[model samples]
Target: MDAKQYDTLQQSLSPKPSIIKNCLKAFLVGGIICTIGQLITFFYMAYFNFTERTAGNPTVATMIFLAMLFTGFGLYKKLAQFAGAGSAVPVTGFGNAVISSAIEHKSEGYVLGVGGNIFKLAGSVIVFGVVSAFVVALVKLLLVTVGVTNW
Candidate 1:
């Protein structure tokens, strides 16, 4: 009836979360995803004659493409459900977000719906990445100008 009574009732009715178990699951799943990415990087370096530095771009593209395929097949949903933030803290998650938005809006037509909405979720990520890179570059430039660092 009273606010305090309702609060107590809600607290008592809620189930306790298994923090340790959830964290273990997330850690394992995230580690596996990163390992897969690393393997892809190695493959590119070994087979495509790409150096370690040059392999990074192709590795990232491969990971994102795989994520988009999984999202389209509805497999990423299950993985996200099971792995929680594990499946979401990687570059693959960005691909999943872009494709999922497009798939959800496909019914309204390609240009107005899919094209316009495809980047709805990923736009913030892109902006943040660009801004962060600019800030880091500015800092590096200042440091270089002051003779504190080299290019």
Candidate 2:
């Protein structure tokens, strides 16, 4: 396009409030998720008598389970509605994606319905991540064998 037209379009599309608002929203949501995790850790230790280490790691697992359960029962949708990425960026989000997909496909019978749907979002990611790790390890070994270890 001509320079004048390009400049006009660029000015028209220049950064605006909508972009800033969306970014602030994302930041707030992420902060809220971290805050929720902290609260869970505190409560686990205070109320459940859990040790510090157990409370930290296991609360995350528990939250993931609850997110899956809620997604299965269609409750997590509301949580996402309220918390936005705050709720959807964690392990809980992974659970929600998995359970929701499984529930969506439940009418297709056991094999495809239950099994196929379980890992719809996460399955491929997990597989590729593991495979890529193996490749990276092999490369590292080869590099070490060649005496090129100091990168």
Candidate 3:
């Protein structure tokens, strides 16, 4: 190949600052998400008579709900504007994906409506994650039964 052609190919394959930037963004956003959950945990424990451990799980669930709610209300778009892939690379993104699809398709009417399209983008990730977990479990089971693995 010509040097120019090789350079172009290399540029296409090489990692860019944007990818690293997005990843760091995802990390920061994800971290901020966890931090919010932590604050909720503390709030519940201190003000609502809940124990620390009991508060945490529910706080996370609430965060997911709020994220979904925000997306439903068209608020997540603004956050995504600020956070970039930070907002796009978390469970909040999944919520936005599902809810936004639902709203976008809501005019299609009942069966063909929100229910049918709500999961559009996020569904693939959900399916992949579940399938991967099942595969990992099966592999572990096989390894155990075959006596070739030790944890």
Candidate 4:
């Protein structure tokens, strides 16, 4: 086929995406996830004697644990398919990615497969998160030293 004809055929064969529908699905799913997290944080603050700042750690850990569980049970993939980027823009998404990799590699062996590959997708995230936090702290320290901001 000629280039122009082939391009036209490809365009005709591909299904068009509905941008508004996808956006609405993503917004609803992502909002629900965030609301669940907020509820967890408040529960901790109210019942566990955790302050707002201290409550965040447990809330994040709980969310990650739940995400990992969902990933293991193969539910997160279905959710991702339905929610698109909505299921992937949170810390829970990071947990899902890491656990999914491990599950995929679990067949080869525990040590060489699951353990080795578990961090493949998440290592960059960890390294970058640590580096970014360090950089931000350094900038804060510099600002304090220069009297641009107070500690």
For all predicted structures, in order, the TM-scores are 0.87, 0.64, 0.72, 0.82
Candidates in order have lDDT scores of 0.93, 0.79, 0.81, 0.92
- Residue 35 C-alpha lDDT in model 1: 99
lDDT of 1 at 46: 86
Please state every model's RMSD to the true fold in angstroms: 2.0, 5.0, 4.3, 2.6
Model 1: residues with Cα > 4 Å off, grouped in runs: 1-5, 147-151
State which candidate, 2 or 3, has the greater lDDT.
3
Model 2, residue 52: distance off in Å is: 6.6
lDDT of residue 77 for candidate 4: 90
Ten residues in sequence with the least summed lDDT for candidate 3:
17-26
Collision pairs in model 3: none
**In lDDT terms, which candidate is top?**
1
The residue-by-residue lDDT of candidate 1 on 8-95, one tens digit each, is: 9999999988888878888999999999999999999889989999999999999999998999999999999888878888889888
* Full ranking by lDDT: 1, 4, 3, 2
